[model samples]
Target: MSKKLSFTVKLLGVAGGVFLAAFLSLLAAWFYVQNWLKTPLQISDAGYVYELKQGQSLGYLANDMGVAGVLNHPRLLRLYARLNDANKVHAGEYFFPQGTTPESLLQKLIKGDVILYQVTFVEGWTVKQALAALEKMDSIEHLLAGKSSADQLALLALPVKDLEGWIFPDTYSFSRNTSDVEIVQNAYRKMQTLLETEWEKRAPNLPYKNTYEALIMASIVERETGHHSERDQIAGVFVRRLQQGMKLQTDPTVIYGMGDNYKGRITRKNLEEPTAYNTYVIPGLPPTPISLPSAASIKAALNPAPGRALYFVAKGDGTSEFSDTLDAHNQAVRRYQLNRRSDYRAAPPSAVGN
Candidate 1:
């Protein structure tokens, strides 16, 4: 009787183990089925654009999308997300196609694959021009549509009075729904960081008393010539002029002082009209930067090319001929400026960063 009782207990234990195994197999099959079989997304040919903001929940989005007829079953998606450990997703604009499944959409979210939008603040753009471009981008949420430069600075928490020459020039990328102020602040910080780096490595005995002053010179160089080869040359002439305590007499500075009323030409009357930006009359660095300087222009200003040349005239073909003497400079002016043949292929006008 004892042997029979022990055999019976062993048989019961074996049956329970088989039952548990079959239950687990069925559960595993169900998990896979729920994860793989999802309703096709309802979207048009243009696709659906969904925005996921920072700190938003995927479960909530799944339900929201379900109500919008994009998903047939939200609970299944939420369950699959929990089971597959794919609950986290990046914040950005997501583009979903008509036939996209819940599994695929969740995969994209988990992998942090979101839509990319770009905004460029090119070299030589003024704060106003850059602001205009930022406002025009459909991808970025606009913030500075009617705000003045002072208003923009206040929004960015910048201490300066003007936002003119402070922001860096580059093709900046931000996630969809990013605010314009965020991009502006980022660009300003990038410019500050890079300018400080270049400032620390600057050549000795530069005319600049501060990093801002060097930035001022760089903006001048950026607006002077867009040519890659002439940045240092332009920087050299300006540095030498500053050292000699002579008027910069640069036409761009004069044009900037003229404002929007300048039309297309600069006259003797315009040049003589004294303004804070008129380097031709100011006898020193402008109070603020004239344009957004490129990295190359900034470097050139900090470590200007070696020369004693104090004068430069446009060669009408995007080049400048430098001169150490007033007489030589006058000759270049006659050859380049007086001759109507002068294309004066000036860089995208430095005054307004056009």
Candidate 2:
């Protein structure tokens, strides 16, 4: 019995030794992987720009990187990823700057640290202009091609008749393979959020009954002024007009209604054409906004400058002349718009000049 017990003890000791050896080998392998991850890639030898397209897997990237000398072996990367709980690479263009490590590269790809491309939507651009600008971008995915403004709005779930002046004008950043619709939706959401927020804070008894009307007024103001300081004053004029049962009679609204038919100039008959957007003939704000308004314009619409001035005209030097009385406005129009010599002017207020 004592001999049998000794044999069992020997067997147990051998098993434990084997287990210890295996554990030590695994520990050594773990240390080796960590060290391998720290080593910089040979990507510098090749131009250091790496572009990964959509639907690509980490395994494929590993093989590609190995071929580019960015990784010593694809298998090592796969094994390390499996062991270290690293995520799959994301799709985008990547620039591997100097001293980029395997670990850092993996982190960048897994965390989607892709290089960002930019698209700038300038203020006062019409929907047509905006769409045209979008079509020129090479990086953005053309998901919105051939879609009409109404269809685009339908995609966004907004039941509007027109797409003009809805999207916020700002610089947007995006990755490769990002949908064009996504960018438009992003800008629209920003506009909606801003409009709603401004609507909540609007001054009491303003003629604007809802956020949409405010947006319309804002777009008109945006087109009317090149100077930022004039937004509130111009908005105030429209607001007072709406309240006093007078037509806004803004020329920008008339131009928008004219669409492609608008020549370089507006005529008396053009103002009298009586389209839905012709504010000169229409009783209130246009059915929709006319252009992409800036945040300042939207703000001005909500918080219009306190004034009694009901008339304004372009001063031809990137400014405007505001007057409380039509007679005063006519003289200013004669001086500014018509470029006529005025001896403080004498004609009666015609209710038409500007």
Candidate 3:
């Protein structure tokens, strides 16, 4: 009986010893992971800004962070992330402050706390011009010009066949990972919102078939005049010509058709050329808009000033003369364009009135 009791006691002691050893080992590992191996608070050599491309894994991110001096051990960070179930990470440009810890960094990346780049699309830029500007940004170029215009069109929701005049000019902040298509789409949405509001209060007897036509006229007016006060007057002249079934005879349309080679001058020969976008031959609005127009020009198109003025000649000064009669228009043109010895020599009136 004594021998059996002693054996039982020895077995209980061995089992308890094994359990204690296992518990101590686990506690030490937990302490090392949570307290000892954690990153210290210090500015990283990565200089607070880092760009992560698409398809980059967490392991790659840790390697970069380690090289940038943000992390002391890339492998350890990876292990910690794996244990925490942080397998998926987002890609973007991140602005990391000095002294970011591994845990905080992981949280930020998981939450998609990326840096935003501010981009402003000007009111008068065409779709091509907008794309050129976007290309200048290294982050968004790859996602553009993929398979077809159909794929590109899916990004922007504008009604036009292509993203020509839909992008509204405004300041926008985008993540570094923002796709090219998304940028175009954002601009198109903003333009749509603006047009919907303005279309409700359009002027009576306007020649435009709809808001789209009004937008086309507004783009023309934007290119025609730099003077804000003259916008409505210019819009009125175009409206009058359209009602009279007369050609727009605007020089901007011809220049637009010429594309990148426009040398700031539109010769008489250029007007005679047959192009699908040439307003001189097409008569009505062009197939698509030539340029983006400002809100003021859009308003002018929707609510043009009441007038019989069918012709306008830019005086040597910034202002232009509007005339109801052909003889009056001819006299204005002669005074502004023919006589170059006067104060208007800087902008010697070109013979724009016929």
Over 92-184, each residue of candidate 3 has an lDDT whose tens digit, in order, gives 888778667777888888998998787777877786777768878876645665446676676555567766667887788888757777887
Tens digits of per-residue lDDT, candidate 2, 63-89, equal 998887677867988887887788467
Name the weakest run of 10 consecutive residues (lDDT summed) in model 1.
345-354
Ranking of candidates on lDDT, top first: 2, 1, 3
Question: Which pairs clash inside model 3?
Answer: 337-349
Instruction: List model 1 lDDT by residue over 199-298, tens digit each.
Output: 9999999999999999999988888874789899889888888898887777777667777886776655655678998775688888888899999999
Rate residue 121 of model 3 by lDDT. Answer: 76
Of candidates 3 and 1, the better by lDDT: 1
In model 3, how large is the Cα lDDT of residue 108?
A: 86
Query: How many backbone clashes does every candidate have?
Result: 1, 0, 1
What are the models' TM-scores? 0.85, 0.85, 0.71
In order, the Cα lDDT scores of the candidates are 0.80, 0.80, 0.75
Residue 133 CA displacement from its true place in model 1, Å: 0.7
Q: Record all residue pairs in model 1 with backbone atoms less than 3 Å apart, i.e. clashing.
A: 316-344
